[model samples]
Target chain A: MTSEHAPIIEMRNIEKHFGSVIALAGVSVDVFPGECHCLLGDNGAGKSTFIKTMSGVHKPTAGEIMFEGKPMHFADPRDAISAGIATVHQHLAMIPLMSVSRNFFMGNEPVKKVGPLKLFDHDYANNVTMEEMRKMGINLRGPDQAVGTLSGGERQTVAIARAVHFGAKVLILDEPTSALGVRQTANVLATIDKVRKQGIAVVFITHNVRHALAVGDRFTVLNRGKTLGTAQRGQITPEELQDMMAGGQEMVALEGSLGGTV
Target chain B: MTDTAQTPEQDERVKEISSFRKALIRPELGGICGTVIVFLFFAIFAGNSGMFNSQGVLNWSTVSAQFMIIAVGACLLMIAGEFDLSVGSMIGFAGMMIAIFSVSLGWPVWLAIILAFLICMSIGALNGYIVIKTGLPSFIVTLAFLFILRGFTIFIPQQLENRTIIGGIADAAEGDWLAPLFGGQVGGWFFEFLGERGLIEVFERGTRAGEPVVDGIPMLIIWALVLVAFGHFLLTRTQFGNWIFAAGGDAEAARNSGVPVNAVKIKMFIMTAFCATVFATCQVMEFGSAAADRGILKEFEAIIAVVIGGALLTGGYGSVIGAALGALIFGVVQQGLFFTGVESSLFRVFLGVILLLAVILNTYIRRLITGER
Candidate 1:
């Protein structure tokens, strides 16, 4: 779904450094509501660095982040979560042995009954987690199942589902489909589309250009800790976009001599 | 379609493994089995010669009750992954205090009991507080307390004796007020089951057709039941119960979930000491004696009961029911070996073997189900 909407999250001149190594240097990006804004880059192009800035895992050295146009600094990941921003990292932050319902309500669980004889609202937790999963276009088994038994793609889907159910306004996925096969990738991308339909702003951070092109509303390219270009859908062809991502003309020739190893 | 990543059969297999794994880690099965084996052995062997009458039953059960009560508390500590070796000394200290107040000071039984309970709870609180503040393992904290407390109880009593202190613990057991409760079979209560209440059956079959119904059931059994039920409720039902499980299961995860891990652990350490205090109170109340030499190595018995009860030494998994059963198993073994003409030294060796075997079984079953990360 495409919308003529105002931007939800806008990062201006974000700069981050780890001692001497510049992970993210003066990178700026925007995420709009009801849009899957793909943040694409190669291994060292600062894709991870940029997402960490949005996620509150890394505070920018110099720049500022604006959520709904109000500048904010996140103190921790918990603060990031409460600020309608959540990241589903590569490790899929979950206790593998814990039940799906328990993991869904890990940090924030609903309490039930009287004190000294109180009980965990397991039924409500299961129902809510299941409902969220269904809304994400994923048909899962009972929430009692251990998440460790689920497929890698399914696990990632559940993580995304969790972020959405917990009222995340800006969903930041860090390479969600990189290790999955084609069908699983399709399933994940479909799940992403489901999130976009809810009118939440989704930052689909990835390196796979085709995956980005498939579901992204806007594409931003980062290279060597600097923003190469930011383009709306259909503004630049995939080939032109690839050339920019490779660092313009000089790098194009260098890539040609390197036999397109990238 | 040509290369499917997952097979449906494999998925089912994983599900089965997880379901089975949940059962294997319950932490009660070991204790129950041990109880049954020990009970049958005693019943079969302790036939005609020994004091296996109704009064005898009450006496043994009352003795087991102290272990039961303490083991229930120790079970909680073990589930949180810690141990206290000073429980024996704690018991001595508390009992001595009770004797001092009830006999030496000529105070009433109820007042003395209340004061003693408070003193014991305070000792427990102190032990727990010290361990948490120092970040020392409970083994060291409790072990140090044990000998220090033992010396305190004995040295104080000897000094009082030297000073010719009046009424120095002579009348502590003279009255029938509180002693009858811990004594069992003479105004004692065990547990209500189905419709009938279960109490100790005491008699010599030579004169009596059935087991003699004794007066005043063991108050220790009543107290032990309260401890067991309370433990079961705390471990399985309440949010703190859930926190307890989580803390023992994985402390980091529990902390991340805002479980108040440090506070819960400190409380657990104190609770163990508190239970030791209660057990010691019952001991002196039953016997009318509170010497320093008593309660030695009682910590080992509590630990043994917990182990036999099927609690994992690693923490985060056990049941109070299992611990009670574990106590029963110990009681049966202690009495049964005498009937079978087994030497006491040999009996201990047998216990060690059973302990080793049971733990092995527990670990093997655990591996079979969880299948490792």
Candidate 2:
């Protein structure tokens, strides 16, 4: 568990609510540098709400988030970004009509000042985008090509590379491989591995146990807005992880009853 | 990853196609070709009527200049994913403001011009604010302003002067240092030299005897060119321009990517308003008067020009240069019809047909480039 190294981010008893609805309750997790921490859950299991709180999309109703062993509170996603925590959302947050370089450096654009004018440093942006993407194993045709022409997996890789290049200490990916094809899923998983090797902590959220087993060093399962438990990679088997994610005996009994009626 | 990667061989093959052919497939290519075809069509049919002469060129260039000014603004706004239907009415309103302030209220022409810009830009900011705050389509919000401003253009003038027409703008603006910059022709000496050398026609019957009719380039054309260049640079070379494309392409995505989508869109609206005011300033100065009905249906003309320039009506893809060419095509067809001795009203039919054809061609080319099925 690398007890010698302090965890980069630690959450204690995190809780979130939307009006009368309890979206999450007492979900706690930890992310360490150079580790892929997979968060597994079923539909409506509050996995999204938990990550939203961690990434500053939503404020937790009651909890303590410690970043680098210091209590942290983010007012919004921008604050998280400034704090070196980057989240690549499920939609990937990409403008399809924009060029690769533009999308890559969107908010953190590089500029070249000429007298009184600050112009987008096209050559620098294009070169850095191409180089960073190449490091992620994506050989772009050119930085000026529209992102719409890229595959879903390539777009995800671009988002990951952008986060890494921007010096993110913790990269949170929300279902990065859910909509991808089999090969695309592998490509994205490989990109996550590459990101981890760069010493950035990755919070990989997914419902797919196989994908988690492939890249996860630790797994945290959530059910009905509460964390079931956390397990190290070698400590838990995929089948056990799958059952825990599906609610174990409760899910089996429901299936048995449904199968009998059918 | 290997499957997704483009091999160097394939990359080389992609480079094999000439950049010219690549350029030919761009959205603006249609506008360039359309401009050429339209220009040649008019030149061949209206050759005997001076359609190709300096006099005819100056006449159409003046009209094209006005449209180009607003079209560039419209093109930028459309790229930023919003519409300002109030631009036409904004012209009338801004013109009235200038006339009321300068001619009626006896303010300095420069002060009045600045005041008019401030007021128009405020209205534009309000338009953007309401659209963003209420989450309503800008089309609806600006459509309401279109009527509201048009009504005010008349009502305010009537309230102040007891008439809808505000006159003496030229007299009031006379002797002001800024007047010539916004109003007068620029290349008169050069044109006169050409006329003296018998290289260009010198009108024998109009104005002073044997004076060159074309004179210098109109201020409107100069302003239009400057704006086009500025708009092109802003859209292609600046981070703000990149934000504009992101804002229009997907507002949520742009926001998530840390782009100030709201700010970009609001600025686009303000720019459109500013352009409308510029148009009003030029027209009022050149005509020496302001009318409540000035710039009627000009919003449609600007949108048409933008669309013909290869911008999508839906937003996110366009160019200022293309828009300038679109305005030129419009000007040629409009003046060419006059030179051909055809009824000017037929210009509307031509506009409609050209818009339809250009949109169709643009869609086809976009499909080819994007490989959209």
Candidate 3:
């Protein structure tokens, strides 16, 4: 998947600042179509800021974002969405009390007109929601089931299926599996595999090394708001990637403090 | 039966049963039960006192109708996750505006009514704007409006007429084309027939030539039913209704999905104020006068009714029908108390108890559905 086709999105020296604090300093990464480009980083390592800039949550102080080989600027998340970029935040942005179908079509609902009145087409929304979730291998009991009753992995799957059904070209998922258990993590990784197969570019951001190694086609690591390097799968081992994510010098210092015991 | 031996009909029946069970746990179910219990209590205790008679029923229905008008609006606003404490004050202010414009300023009654609605809606919009712009809870913002509007209601009348009471509104509206639409009664012939046939008790006093004076269904009751139907439709069926649910459930999530939460809340506030004005207009036309204290404490009553209807105070869940039923319960208890020789002040205690019980029941039902505890 690497270098076989032109990159779908290319970021060059993206910098973001909040007054005197630098959230992202000269960080760059590229994602290709049908590839799970894992953004590997620890907390405060600028991974979130980078993802935010890419998804149009924030404007970069200095940088250029080329989407599909053309310069792109997004005023907000809606602008990014209209341009075929969708983001599923770490919080998931779902109303737990609402029905699954309602959550699936929250901001964009289907409507039918009767006489002079326009109404939410519940049948259409329910049928499409169930069908889309089924495509991701989730057999929902019913579209009217409250989302709050769903497991964490199922919720993440719903978000992924929603992004895909909405025609998202590049899906940016921020730390999707950080709060899930082992089996749930596997489910999310499997969903990512299904998404990748659909030729939609997926930027899977996470701090978990094993989860990334399981499904990522390529990995770009950030340390203290700066990119350490980008590596293709099989080019870098999981241990090497983990040490790099923790900062190579810090890992060395911790190892020395332990006296290389056992 | 073995797992694979079940027929499609059995599967369909299982689904139907489960769905029916799901419906049973809905928030409105509590309100429905409460309505039935209150009706039964009044029927058993106050039945012989004419509380169940046609005239007595009409009396309570009219009162409930007034409360329902504001309760439906409050229910919608609550569903959208906000409050309008200024609703009671808005009613007084709107009535004052209609009185001043129609009687004092000698304007046409219909024109005055329209202007009053527009002005009240603007104030409602302002309440919404301040809450959203300042990121303040609507409770605090509308609380401020409650006092501000109440003060104006009194001060404005004193400034213009040197009195707190405005009169002659009924006279101004008497022959107006819009008077019947907002102010008169229906079903007079039917009620007259009932009275003549001795099916309904004719009033001994306040009668004209041995005929019952209260011979029709008050227009307020009709307006309430219409508003309830409309509100229910808007909350459950429309796209805007979905937005209301989304906005109330989680404003940030709704906004992230491209629902304009701010606009929706503002519109809800405007509708609430519009409903208050409608109530005020009809009352003034019926009574021929408006007082500065016309709707004092009405805000709490509307909220109480809405809560009884099964809407969570925290927002995101409710039904307009439930609120209407809550209003009916309120009317029954209020008039029933009088008929049963209970002190009217006990009505306050009844409201307090019912509100607490409804809140507790609503929370319990929600937890049951969410499987929280």
Candidate 4:
């Protein structure tokens, strides 16, 4: 239903090459407002390269990025971030030893001026951090608790909540559930669902078909630096998506050769 | 997992830590504990030795102020994930620069001090630049500078005056406008009043009879307190302080989060250099000369103080107050040994033992926070 609205972000014919390696060959993806667009791929299927280009970590060798109907060029990730594109990487980009509130506002800290000195507003930061965490449904023991003490799922939630609080319009999550347990994965997927309902476009990249299908409204599969296809929810089945992620016909030929040998 | 949806006050997952455990995780716990133990030991063993008397207290306090100066710099730099092995050398070099300019070259004393600061801080900036550009470890980069600066300290004096020691700096600096800020003492009248009331010891048999033996506080001690207070406030209350922690904690993560890691590191290096120069100026003013080897091994002493203050060798976590306490311990122990009729050389052995114990404590605290075995 949201597809009736124009895409909040659009990429056209994006190509990236790294010294004789074609990491992304004219790959493109469009994320709509209030949609979870899952980018599904196998280990070396160019998903990482594609998202890196989208988030301004890498300049596309050839392509144009349209952000909200205007042609855009990002000089660096900081530029992309200021434009409301936030990437929560596989490592989560969080310092584990810092307090939760500190990590919550790493770059964009809140300060209150006392006389001539500008001080970090601890009361405001703590209140906002706790309130945001509560909204994400993860109750912290305290804002001062180190992020390292939190579970993996809770850390992901912190990353997500930080992005949302900072007013990120496009949240790019790279393999967020790859290292999580079953229960944790469910929590993250639920968090994703909650985030999407807030009208932010989420670019969720992962290899797990089940996790992708759990919350994704639109799915795009990349194989060997090329888009295999894009499908809306209810237009594709789990087995078909899994087969595509496994390189579809390539898996069939490998099995044939194995069968002949047996 | 879904239990997170419950109100935080009623949530079982939000397990409140016991106050004891909470206190144990503080970065200053080890330093505070070490301070208490050392003071108690000194009181028990050196009580009658007058080690706690007015003049005796001033002696150890002045020495502690020296360590406190450099430890403030080292603590901040270490927390920012870099090492400056050239700090001691910078001190020697800076003092030598001031001596050469003021005593030999006939420059005004204030100008010499300002020039020395500029030159040393530039070297600090260069250290940061090379480390950042080459992606080399700061340990190696600063180690190289350690030798380079020390070499200059010796080479410059020898070439200028045919001697590695320069004198007449105090004479040249006498009555200079900026010299008093570093070398002067304060509160003379208060001490005189104390002596008049017999609250403090007074000279008994010299031309200075009836005057308090300990007249006033030295500027070095004041500088140390100011630096510590400034560092504590900066680390705890400012945005730049948070950036320092982030830059040291994880450079990649901090960069990804939009922190200017390189700039923060460079600023920290410059700060380290500034602290070293302050130390050198104060020392040169007090002693009336500069020698090439004056600050030998002071770099390691500063680092040891910072580590003993409960900072991790890996960086990102520390406290300036803790480092100040560590310096206080060093001063008390170094002076206490002499007062107690013990071998002063035993101080080195104590340092070794205490350093090992501090590392053990820091590791334990690290595990406590990280929940690692």
Name the candidate that leads on DockQ: 4
lDDT score for residue B358 of model 3: 74
What is candidate 4's CAPRI-style docking category based on DockQ?
medium
Candidates, DockQ: 0.16, 0.46, 0.37, 0.51
In candidate 2, what are the lDDT values of residues A138-225, reduced to their tens digit?
6666787778777888889899889899999999999999999998898888889888988999999999888898899999999999
Per lDDT, what order, best first?
4, 2, 3, 1
lDDT by residue for model 1 over A31-81, one digit each (tens)? 888898998887889988788788877889988899988998898667788
For model 3, which pairs clash?
A: none
What overall lDDT goes with each candidate model?
0.73, 0.88, 0.87, 0.90
Quote the lDDT for B76 in model 2: 95
Give the range where candidate 1 chain B is weakest over 10 consecutive residues by summed lDDT: B186-195
How many angstroms is residue B335 displaced in model 1 relative to the true structure, after the best TM-score fit? 2.5
lDDT of 1 at B85: 83
TM-score of chain B of each: 0.82, 0.94, 0.92, 0.96
| Model 1 whole-model lDDT (C-alpha atoms) | 0.73
Q: Compute fnat per model.
A: 0.11, 0.42, 0.49, 0.52
Query: What interface RMSD, in Å and to 1 decimal, does model 3 have?
Result: 7.6
Candidate 1 local lDDT, B1-373, one digit each (tens): 1223232422434433355546655556666566666666677767664547665676567667777888988899888767878888888778877777777777877677778878777777787788778978778988898888888888776776542122334355556465555543433233222113334444436664244356556667888888888888777555566566556766665553445667788778778877887787667766667777677888888888888777767776667888888787676666667656778777788788767766666555444322324
Evaluating just chain A, the predictions reach TM-scores of: 0.90, 0.94, 0.94, 0.93
lDDT of 3 by residue, B1-373 (tens): 0112112322333234366677788878778887888888888888899887777888889889998999999999998999999999999999999999998899999999999999999999999999999999999999999999999999999999999999988888978987677788898998788788877777766536557656788888999999999999998898999899888888877877778899999999999998999899889988889999999988988998999988878778788999998888888888889998889999889767877777788778877654444
Candidate 2 residue pairs in clash (backbone atoms < 3 Å): none
Sum up the clashes in candidate 1: 18
